[model samples]
Target: MQRYELAAVTGLDSLTRVERDVPRPGPGQVLIRTTAWSLNYRDLLVAGGRYGPPRAGCVPLSDGVGVIEEVGAGVTRVAVGDRVAGIFMQGWIAGDIPGDAGNTALGGAIDGMLSEYVVLSAEGVVKVPAHLTDAEAASLPCAAVTAWNALVRESGIRAGDTVVLLGTGGVSLIALQFAKLHGATTIVTSSSDAKLDIARRLGADHTVNYRAQPDWDRAVLDITNGRGADIVVEVGGPGTFDKSLAALRPGGHLPLIGVLTGVNGAVSTAAILRKHIRVHGIYVGSREMFDEMNRAIAASGLRPPVDRNFGFDDARAAYEHLERAAHAGKVTLTR
Candidate 1:
């Protein structure tokens, strides 16, 4: 089998493709014939040494979908020929995240799904929605699960509530879809009018081109007739954190999920206190949340946007595309 591993944590050049022997499943494990994969911003961080220093020879992706080609002794959660995706946090099946959960994370803490075949604990995988294509199913484990965790599982989003999305990236676009799935009015912000148009077509009630209107928060207020949005999917980190807060209603829900605009910056602590904002720091999610989201996806027939697809061999090009921020939704790699 062939896989791409981070030979060094310098940049995209570090993704070195190499050959390896396919391993067999041991007790309670499954050997997956991975067919497709997707890139998250976190992948770039791991590649560039921004997230943290990864171990040498670390495989570089957390999101992938495949068929169980073989199963080991006592394995019952999944079987051969089952289509499943590895959960982002391997040990976080349900409830609160464990203190050592990071140690079990794919790509960062362990070998991930960049290879043609992978061995995973049967307990850490979930069957994906059948309606989704391989690329779409592969996109779910990280970005989509985070969106689901933020909107449905935690926020209690309901009809007529307003949601503000930061950019037309994977998480934001998926959040826009899921928010609409629950009947919430969505407002999406992007620097590109073209991307905002795409968001509008995806059921966004209103779109704000942040490049044209620098104070996009005020636009959200105007759209809601002075009542701010009920939820803000805060993906911009400290760079846009204050504006995200300003865009929200009093007692609104804010899921702090991304750091696309760099990690550190000044924050307006008083506004959070004054508005009674509920800021939830969300990672990807537990496997239980992934199952619930998959059920909703299957019911609604939701199709996540795939902005681009690359051949598996062109993994470097896929990473470059995502790094350039040219794509509107998930960028995928397929066999």
Candidate 2:
């Protein structure tokens, strides 16, 4: 079997391909023949040693879709030939996230799906929506699940509510789709007009270019006739936090999902208090959430956008492309 591993967490150059024996399933595990993989911003952080030092020589990707080749003793959740995607946190099967969930995360805490084959707990995999292609299914495990967890699960978003999205990244684009799916009025912001046009085609009701309109919060207010948005999908960190707050209605919800901007800076607690806003920090999601999300996706026949695809051998170039941050949707690799 062929696999890519990080020789060291220096950068994309650290990813090196090597030969390995195809792994067999252990008790309660399933052996998967990985077919496709997707990249997220977190992958960049992990590759650059910014998401904490990953285990030496570990495969470096959390999102992938594959077929079950075999199942271990007592395993019954899925069978051979089942197409499935591994959940981000293998330990977080249901309910709230466990304290040790971080230890079970793929790519960082464990060998991930960047290999031709992988063995994971039978309980950790979910069936892929039949309508989705391999690359689209692979894109769901992290970014799509996080978007569902934020807008659907956490915010309880409903029809007629105004939802604000930070940018046209994976999560934001997916959030735009979900918010529109639920009949919400969607507002999207980007630095690029071309991306905003894409967002509009994806059902964004209004768009803002933060570069042209530095006070985008005021733009949000103007769009909503000063009532403000009911929910803000806050992906930008400290740099946009204040604006996110300013753009929200009193008692609005903000699901803080990413730190695309710098991670730390001063924030105004007074603004939060004054607005009575609820800020929820979203990690990816539990397996149960993934299941619910898959059901919704399958029923709606919604396809996630694939910005680009690379051959398996071009994995390093894929990483570099993500680092450049020009792609509007998920970047994927196919075997």
For all predicted structures, in order, the TM-scores are 0.99, 0.98
| RMSD (CA, angstroms), candidate 2 | 0.9
Model 2, 1-335: lDDT tens per residue?
A: 99999898878878999999999999999999999999999998888788865566879899988999999999988999999999999999999889889899999988888999999999999999999999999999999999999999999999999999988988899889999999999999999999898898898899999999989999999999999999999899999999999999999999998889888989999999999999998989999999999999999999998889999999989988888878888899999
Root-mean-square deviation of every model: 0.8, 0.9
| Candidate 1 structure quality by residue, lDDT tens digits, 1-335 | 99999998888989999999999999999999999999999999999877765576789899999999999999988889999999998989999989888788999888899999999999999999999999999999999999999998778899989999999999999999999999999999999989988899999989999999999999999999998999999999998999989999999999999999888899999999999999998988999999999999999999999999999999999999999998898999999
Model 1 misplaced regions, further than 4 Å: none
Off by over 4 Å in 2: none
Best model per lDDT = 1
Stretch of 10 with least lDDT, candidate 2: 47-56
> Which TM-score value belongs to model 1?
0.99
Give the clashing pairs for model 1: none
Candidate 1, 218: how far from true, in Å? Answer: 0.8
